[model samples]
Target chain A: MKGVGPTTPAASQPPLLEKEGRSSRGAVRAEVLLWLAQRASAAVLGIAVLIHLATMSYAVRGGISAAEILARTRGSLGWLLFYGVFVLAVAVHVPIGLRTIAQEWAGWRGAGLDVIVVAIAFALLALGWRAVWAVCA
Target chain B: MNRAWRARNHPAYWAFLVHRLSGLALAVFLPAHFLVLGQALRGEAGLEGALRWTDSPLVKVAEIAIVVLLAAHLTGGVRMLALEFLPWRDWQKSLAALAAGATVLFGLAFALALVGGG
Candidate 1:
């Protein structure tokens, strides 16, 4: 929001005052909710990632094949739930992180950027859940 | 340049850099990972082909790197959560060290596991 492009100054108003009014309450609320969701998802991901890492490391130690992995994961309701939650958390997490990075690094901000990120989040959820289904369902 | 060098020497700064870099790397990797796993929807043959390709030594090394990145990001994230939710304290400075140590430990464990160490 800081580096958003130049604004037109009204005849009676100062430039800084015009810029300050650009940030709508809805945008602020949405930004706050996005921040909160990222933090909450981060907490869930902290535990989920540990379990994922440990399990994958253990599995790979014995040199697991794809068929073998499928055999274990396929039709397991527990794994389905585990990975489903993982994918969901990732969906909620990554886009928000990327949004911040885009703002800082790419100078991309505002509703257009927000829309793109939400689209990305949905794409992640779809792809991730599809993978989870392929592996576990 | 002096300022940059001085910043690099700080543990908190290093942690911040590592967290940001690792996170960016993981974000870049995620799309590719999802695309590959999309092969799973094509049934066993497609998924198995992708899995077999990952069996190559190069990919194995990359996998280890990914795990290291993941560990670093995870510990870094935990440190952030603590900073946000926990009460302020002098001990917070030590979190960077703790995160680095934990990341290293995870990397070591994964490397050893891959080598078939007990």
Candidate 2:
């Protein structure tokens, strides 16, 4: 009964080890989730880029003016959604990729770098969505 | 100089350089692209004036270069994805060649589209 008591030394040791193990595991999990999110966004961007380029190529063939392009795009819910998704994917994809480049090429790291990238992502999302709304809405 | 010379001849190194440079170029270009699109908010006359400016020969050539950069970045991205997700194999070494080939083909297709049929 003494060994089973709350004051026993054996019972106290596992919690410390468990806490340390959980912290490391959590860090790994967060890193992994960021990696996966970037990859998923990249896949979406690959398809979106193709569609965007193909549409632009076709649209430019007859030398369509901006007004004509806007007329076709405006009030078109399909184009609105297409560009919305494209902007969202770009917002998610670019910052994370840039974070890697910053770390590798520029030797930037830590929370300050992360905050900078997140700010850039928001800026991209704002600018991109504004442009999409102007053209499509 | 020697390191640069060796890197120039290495396909994977070239792929890496293209991917990084194209990404940087596209990042710089996006603000301008968004600004042009923003012209749509100014009504037809405003947008038309901007569009007309883009009709210059220099702009046309720049457009082609932009397409090539986009294509190179995209193919390089795909190569990175494959390397990250796929199981390691001897065929992985050939991915640089494949990506480069695809990027060149994309550039050619865009050029043909721009030039129109003879």
Candidate 3:
């Protein structure tokens, strides 16, 4: 510690490790889990998006009636499951996306970040489910 | 300078270039898609008219090509992101290859589905 005096450049810089305190293990775990969720949701989106696009192209070009499309979708466990998973992925994916946006654009974090993102997720879920129900039911 | 150049010219760099191009392509297609669909909200004649436009061979080929490009860009992006952010750097090459292969196979399948099978 002799050479690491106050005047030394390294000493003047903030310590990478605080002398007595560190982030809790739980915080580190939470950060890692968020990272994993973002990655997994992205993978889901990649596949879902393609299917969504292909289906859109077909439905539009094939001149399928809304009634016909609904007939295919309604009470079909498969469509429900697919879009259900799509909504869930959006829920997880959008929050993590907003995390970056909040950090960069709003310089925000902590509880405020979690609250706003959760609200977006819920809104997406409610709206998405309503639409799905109208068509599928 | 040579080290910097090598990094800039890496396969990762090429992938980044392709992703940006494909994203731009998708952005261009999105508005056109919406406009076409907007026809549906007008009435049945408008909706069928939109379909008539879509059924053109040129439009079919263009749309299918865009889908393929978008798939390539998306899966390639995820592969790059995983390589950079995940703790699985060793598998980056293999994973990238897998993503590329999957994109080609799936894109073709979906394209064929567009024409109601090959």
Candidate 4:
């Protein structure tokens, strides 16, 4: 919006764009917040996913059995906490990622889409915690 | 001018595509995974039933595929974070290649573990 002096006006300018511009930026603030959350959760997940992959890759040596998995996970408070945080991070990370994908691929936007994303976030949280509770409780 | 294909035909775009597709695949699998894990609530029989279901040859393939997708997504995510935070450099361009390579290794290691275990 700068450099629009009498002599410096070099291109076609939309009339009365100042207020609209401010409002648009304000609207983008929500998107900025979502982006921030996604990044933070990604950092958490980077560590968590690596740990998870390593554990699984190394632990399963002669086939997987429910009994062995249960022996390791059942009643383990530490595993519970580890998975709890992992679930929470996934809950935050997946929905935001999906929202972006929806926007880019499906051309879907607006409050309706946001509401659906929120629903997905809650579902992930509930389902994830439920799994944790099953193992830990 | 078919500019879209040209624009997307690069290492970065391939990286982006793999990341997004893997993410989508994982998301689709999440609920089923949660449900299966939650079977622990029903004790050994319940958990055993789910394990038995996954004993099929196809499910084994799917398991491997899921591991590969997860590795791809995880490595791609790390690349994305580095790209966003680190200073730009020519070497940084190779991060995508490195991530892809690492993903293959993860998939291979997971596959080996599964084979040895199974």
Give the candidates in order of TM-score, highest first. 4, 1, 2, 3
**Model 1's TM-score against the true structure:** 0.87
List where candidate 1 sits over 4 angstroms from the true fold: A1-23, B4-9
- Residue B18 of model 3 has an lDDT of 67
lDDT of 1 by residue, B34-71 (tens): 87877877888888888887778899899889999999
- What DockQ score does model 2 reach against the true complex? 0.51
Top candidate, metric DockQ: 4
Per-model DockQ against the true two-chain complex = 0.55, 0.51, 0.10, 0.67
TM-score of chain A of 3: 0.75
CAPRI quality level assigned to candidate 2 from its DockQ score: medium
Residues A1-137, model 1: lDDT tens digits: 54344453444466666677665665688889999999999988998999998988788776756787788888999999999999999999999999998999899978799899999999989989988998888
Model 3 chain A lowest lDDT segment of ten = A14-23
Better of 1 and 2 by TM-score: 1
What tier of docking accuracy does candidate 4 attain? medium
lDDT (Cα, tens digit) per residue for candidate 2, span A48-104: 999987877777775758767987899999999999999899888888878888989
Candidate 2 displacement at residue A102 in angstroms: 0.8
lDDT of each: 0.86, 0.84, 0.67, 0.90
lDDT of 2 at B110: 74
